[model samples]
Target: MKLSKGANAPVPTSLLAVVVSWRSEHAVDAHALLLEGSGTVRSDRDLVFYNAPRHVSQAVTLDQEPAPRTARLSVSLPRTEADVDRIVVAGSVENGTFGDITGLTLTVHAVDGAVATFEIEDADAVRALMFGEFYRRDGRWRFRAVGQGWASGLAGLVTEFGVQVDDPADPARTTHPTDPFRLHRSARTSPSQEVRSARSATGAQPDPAPPGLRDRHDLAPVRHFPHGSFASDPPRRSAQSAREDGATGLTSDDVVVQRFSSSDDDADGRTGQEAAHNRSDASASVRPRTDLLDRAETAATLGSYRPVDLTRHTSETAPAAPPPPPNPDLADWHSDPEAPERLRWWDGTEWTSATCQHHPPSNRHCARCGHPLRRKLLGGLAPCQRCELEIEEYLTHWHTQAWRVLTTHGPRGPVWAALWASLRYQRIDADAGRRALRAVALSYVERLVTFTFADGEVQHAELELFEQAVTELALGGPLIEDLRRRMHRGRTLSRLRAGDLPVVRTPGLHLDPEEKVHVDLPATHVRQLARGPKLTEGRLIGSNKKLRFVGAGAGTEMPWSRIISVHAEQETVVIAATSSRGGGTFAVADPDYVAAALEGALRVAKRLVLTPGQRDTRSIPQEVKAEVWQRDGGKCVECGDGHYLEFDHVIPLSRGGATSATNLQILCRSCNRAKGARI
Candidate 1:
């Protein structure tokens, strides 16, 4: 059988079996009497063994001569590690179910020879059985039954007998008595009395009585015949008066008897008898002439108890009493130092219960009322369970943004920014902040398009791809709508950024806005010069200023920030295009230093240059001028007057003279296209 979690070790031969076909007051009395008389009863009622086929062992012989033909098996609740009892069976047998013996009866016998039989039909019915072995110890009886497991058995048995399990511990019990006639009908037939008599005749006259019951004459007081034995011509008026004579012996009639042994005075000779009489008289004179019952009544009346001399008694609080034993179930987890506190309970196999020495929280009282709340209720957070859930959600969102920000701006910068934003005093409008976050992302996309490739040439296709990536990264619009109707019920995360955005980490580009000219090379590092201006400064016209470059020379400050461009074709080196603080731009190509510094294949250095097609001033092209004049009407030959049009060239060539209307400039076809195709 599987043991319960934290039970004591196995004790040896402490359990006794008292098989009864019924559970009545008489049966209970008989069981208790047997246990008490034997004086070998275990405190836990491990002695009261169940007779079911499952719990009980098979028949085993106690002695060899004239075999008893009775089962005598002993089992113990383990008291120590070495005390476990192994169950053994003598013959082939199947285990018994609880249902097999639910309809039993018990008998309870009072000390006064009054028997009260109770049926096994409810928890109340089995209450006596559950407390089956109260031994008469030191003149006072105490309960000696196993308390926990029997409740289940009792409940199940009562269910079989059509009753519910109720709290029998309640003092207010009103259980109906079982039908006496029906109970008698259901009682199992005991071995016939004639057969017992025959067995007694055949076997060694069954040891006349149980042990410690010898001294037959001393069992009770001597009767009336004992009074005549004094050769009494003078009849005694009272038993006490007869006892006063020297020859008349005292009996239970004169003595207040008890379960505990009490001493008595016996008459020996005339001298001894006189002395005994003298002693009795002196004892009576020392106290009062009151009956023992009167003393008991007086003690009760005075609300006094017999002074308990507890020196000889074993106290429940003695030092030798074992510490609450460990429970066996948590043995494995208790061995680990890092085991959770709640998981650390008493494990019988190991000491795992940790002392929680941490100071408790401050929220000691309930918010709704002033009553003191349990520590666990307020130990973690207000609305503790719900608060934990909220924290988890908050952490999820924080981590999601953390990964993205770290990848883009690196750990230190992004982490500091996040910390600052979180701690700042300014009010954060979450909705508008989210919109501005979109603009920030788009600005980075625009900046990345300005980067030149390794060949020092920028591709419009790359720019288009960058734009597509930005569009793809945007919150889903049409695609999510299509997916909603086709694949899912509806789009839950409509605001979620798209995952299709490509991660492009082009080298030789200023990936971060704050820092500049970050080149991972060996010796000759090229960074924007700190003493120079940024590329954003400076007019289109050139002044006398020389371009700043990141070179090893005596400069006021290091020009590491003045990295305007880079060149890696045939050489892994960076070129400075602009500098911080309005410094000029310059290229970096120290062959010995650059070659020694640069590692890896010099595929091509990416450059950052102005877009060649973009100009500071705007002007109309020749095609746009032609199209405008044609769309507007031809002008008059005299004034070259045309509605919102300029003079245009015609087929009349200036090389060969041919006076045609197209050759003349008439503004708005008014001057025969004046000043157009003229010689």
Candidate 2:
């Protein structure tokens, strides 16, 4: 297998794309490129030579020798100097070959007998051909999986190498593995302390703190920076007088960071045989810049492992502390008003509980909690500890409307179908959306339903859906009364199909009017309705007493106004709205939408009552104020101010906040903070 060219050899102006076909069972087929030269190839036959140097080599390596195989060839015409600079060799598992590629290695030799070898992963060896140096060592090769650094080599070759192997493999070829290249070591003048900031505060860098320095909780010991105390220090380069003379320029913590390496053939190393197996530690040189072991160790620490304290000198490290208890404030935000607690905040660099003196302490209350005093106690998103009963209730309501429109009329079930189509374009997958607790199909419908609500103008025809749905409800009958003015009447650019149901929006809405009006809406309330030419796959439902609409097309009949008070109690939200003309009470399912709608309706009410005369009239009877106070549990909404309170509309009535007890709230002096009279 001595493939070579001499001093008088023709300069290859094009690259040779080689593809080997083989079969294997027990052993995987592999290949490697051992040379670089310019030439062009086409399939298993055509070959064209051009004017370029050489610069490509790849190997299809295997656990055992490759099975009987044929090589396919292709040529890439030279375009720049890189094409003439080096050579390239690529390997592949021949067509109809058997078994997987278990391992691979490549070896390249120059005219002057300069040889370079590399053991690469079976799949990536040939791809690694882009890097000129490719060779095998000792006849045995160990393949390793690719990591982040491999992508760097690809960029360098295409941009820096100028040589492009344009003939990519056919449909079935496997992807290339990463190439592991050695990074040149940086020069060290004199070693300095690598200290954590805590020790840096003092005048000088503190000596390396021994391991277990803060072992006991009661010890209250201090730790200095430059942690490698046990390691030896580098020699100083001083020349002047004793004090100003030949002063050892090296600081007390100055130490030459060195790595211990063992020769490949050496059997006298600390871990001897075990160390020999790892190629990274097989460097013979002790030179600070030439040692691969040191580079490998540094890379290993930064690339994969967490920062570790390796100093063997024992001084007793502090015991890890138990996590803090969950904050009660966050419990109210979750579906369940009374869920178990979780861990609180930790501002440490690595959750080590070691605080930085310069940084402010984390707030005690949970950050995500609506309670100004409470925060999201846990680190990130905690698992679903509470039941999704509220979400399910909302979904139930959405489902009723979804099922009605999906099964009832039109050519394409309901709005859910269009939504699924839009989500597909958004690149949203079921797994990702579900993880975020979003229903893809439902989101499509909701977007179409609410686009024109908050914003004054409707940007698209979808606004008609929200307008139509809202019209069926009595409370804000005039809210969406002008459907034509809000929407652009465009052609049917998109429609939901029957088979596309899985990808389309599914609507759900729940209406409970017992103690209070509770509106439960499906979680898919946010995805876009349509994108480019695709319709999104989710829907939203606005549930008021009179109307329960799904998408822009469907609705469910419910006595929503007959609702009384709606509040979260434990796992369920109770709604106490009256039915049969305020005679008997109907305790329907949970309604999450009611709160949000109340917020929306209040905004409308506030706008309605914003007249100058309305401000001084004091139309809110004293009796109404008393009821509102009791409903709020006599708590302030601002500053947490408790006394000298007044009745305020949660959603100001002028903006559509109702005169109902549920819409009004009690606010103390501090609670009203800057909430001036809007009317």
Candidate 3:
């Protein structure tokens, strides 16, 4: 079994061998500290090392010998004192830091020959590391992979756990290493070092090999609990008891160390050793016959959890809580620090079935509606669940996201120019920015090209893969088009953006000068305003100046000023105009966008009347920008990207939208430019 850092598995038995191996020319000393329940050692007597290789209780022993690159320790848990709850395994190198040595590994071999291994992946420049521990939890002993290090070496490590450091009385002690984990040794100090037969003549390792060392070898994957799973197992039976019970060749080590998710209080309000005993009897009654298969268990016993390894980022306002004890505060919900996107409810004393959808997948949050996606809606350019209107419908949502991204990435200008500025910001020279953007673009293209499967329908995952891709790469145009088509949903995103605008021209329409079309919903059906029962098949055509429903006959057209507010339904829009006007209820393909387009066109008509010569000015009020920044979480409104931000007028100002906070939304240059990409 391979254990990841911070992961734990129960040891079937206490009598086990732990070996620390690394490929280094320098000798690395291994030490074990027997810790009490209070987390401190009883005294220097509990320390096991080269000089003091055996514990007073006869429960633990340092092998004092190694197989080439490995050091071993034998632990007999049954012989350990009840007061001693944990055995901490640690190692150190006095010659240099662990970073200088590679391939550091810890292997635990149980009496049943079950093996669990952990490799320290991130070896820092620290002198010592608390590799892991075999600790008692609810009467069960489990092994945890703890790769924490100490920069101050073993002295600081021992002192932290209440060990006193004193100068040795013997003169040779002065020459010997003082750090508990790093017992100093050298060939120059020993007179017979040359003829010591390759043994650690420095006395760290025994010259003669230890017994039982020859039996250890590669073993099969132990039939154990699954990773990050909860299991049910009783208090471990002794090796003698298992043999007498005739349960195959299983020993006390044959039992798996298991953890429960809840307290006994949730049952009959039990506590202390009484709680443990009662639970043991209760679980033993349900324990299945293991003799049915000595090699593997038919199924996993069900129950709960173990130690938590939390690594998550919390909101800026409230820092994450420290790793809590087995039971902290009783009630309410707390973040699952390991899985950031989940909330685990603490029902006063134990975990309950209470849960809710947790935080979003990204670190960013949306400003206007407090969406977890920040400006990016559902990891796409689509409208947020709350704010369903397109950019043109509402214009007060982009300032803060824009300013933040703009300043960090250089400046906000044209869509592609802004992203270029952000990507190339602070580059060494003029060509640096271009090279950087091209690199990103190439990487994006490369990923899609490598995936051979190209079914016509695009999966959400595929679209998200290129949701932030640089769409304007001239050299990648042809391939990007093919990839875009493969990933696009129903229609191209460029069409969606165009559909959100204040104008969408129908191909065959002959329009008058300045009579711009805003929206065109095809395959639409209509009903008359005069309470006519018959339905008419038509296309709903919306322009900046009017709303028209064209069918087989002369189409009905009404000026925007005469129409009342548009009501949007699932797949239809209700256009209520004056009794004399031609507007009517129309069933359309996308009523939301159609309704929003009509509303936008009406606003444009009103704006044109109010300011006939008004031109688009790319400026937002500072106060409004500040409010927008706070609301949109200071990131792009479409996607929470914080670089090269531009205040994307959801509805452009040229279409008669106001420069208001409600209409402002920040979008990164990449997202803003991706609006026109085919995908």
Q: What TM-score fits each model? A: 0.12, 0.18, 0.26
Per-residue accuracy of model 3 over 1-679 as CA lDDT, tens digit each? 8999999998865689999988768678788888877888765556676546777566788887678888888989767765678999988777789888888999999877756899997878999888999998655678999998899887667667766554334343322211111111232433223214334544544322111011123111122211111235534443234223322111111111101111211232211111111122222222322221111111111001121111112366344454643544223345654544444444322443322234344445432223444355556544343322311111111222222333332121122232232211111122433343353445334433222121112234335535434334433556566555545532232223223363454778978777777677674555554677557777777787777778878577878778866756445777777864465667777665566567656656665322211212444544666566667765677776654455555665546666777876666657766652122
Candidate 1 lowest-lDDT run of ten = 178-187
Candidate 1 residue-wise lDDT at 308: 12
| Tens-digit lDDT string for candidate 2 (1-679) | 2222211122222333333333332322222222223322111101111111121211122222223443332333332211122223332222222223333333332334413333343333222223122222222221211211122323222323222233333454322211011122232311122223335655554433322211122222222221111123223321112112212111111112111111211222211111111011102111112222223323322221111121122236544544322332111111111212322112111121111111122354222211123224775443221113222332333334433332222113112332222222111233432333223223333323322222122222334444433332211323233333323321111110000011112233233542222233442212223563322222223222242324344323334444444333222323334542322211223322233343233223233213211222224544565465445554565555543455555675446766556666656534543564343
What lDDT does model 3 reach?
A: 0.50
Q: Considering TM-score, where higher is better, how would the candidates rank from best to worst?
A: 3, 2, 1
Clashes of 2: 147
Better of 2 and 3 by TM-score: 3
**What's model 2's overall lDDT?**
0.27
Q: What lDDT score goes with residue 197 in model 2?
A: 38
Lowest lDDT 10-mer window, candidate 2?
Answer: 492-501
By lDDT, highest first, what's the ranking? Answer: 3, 2, 1
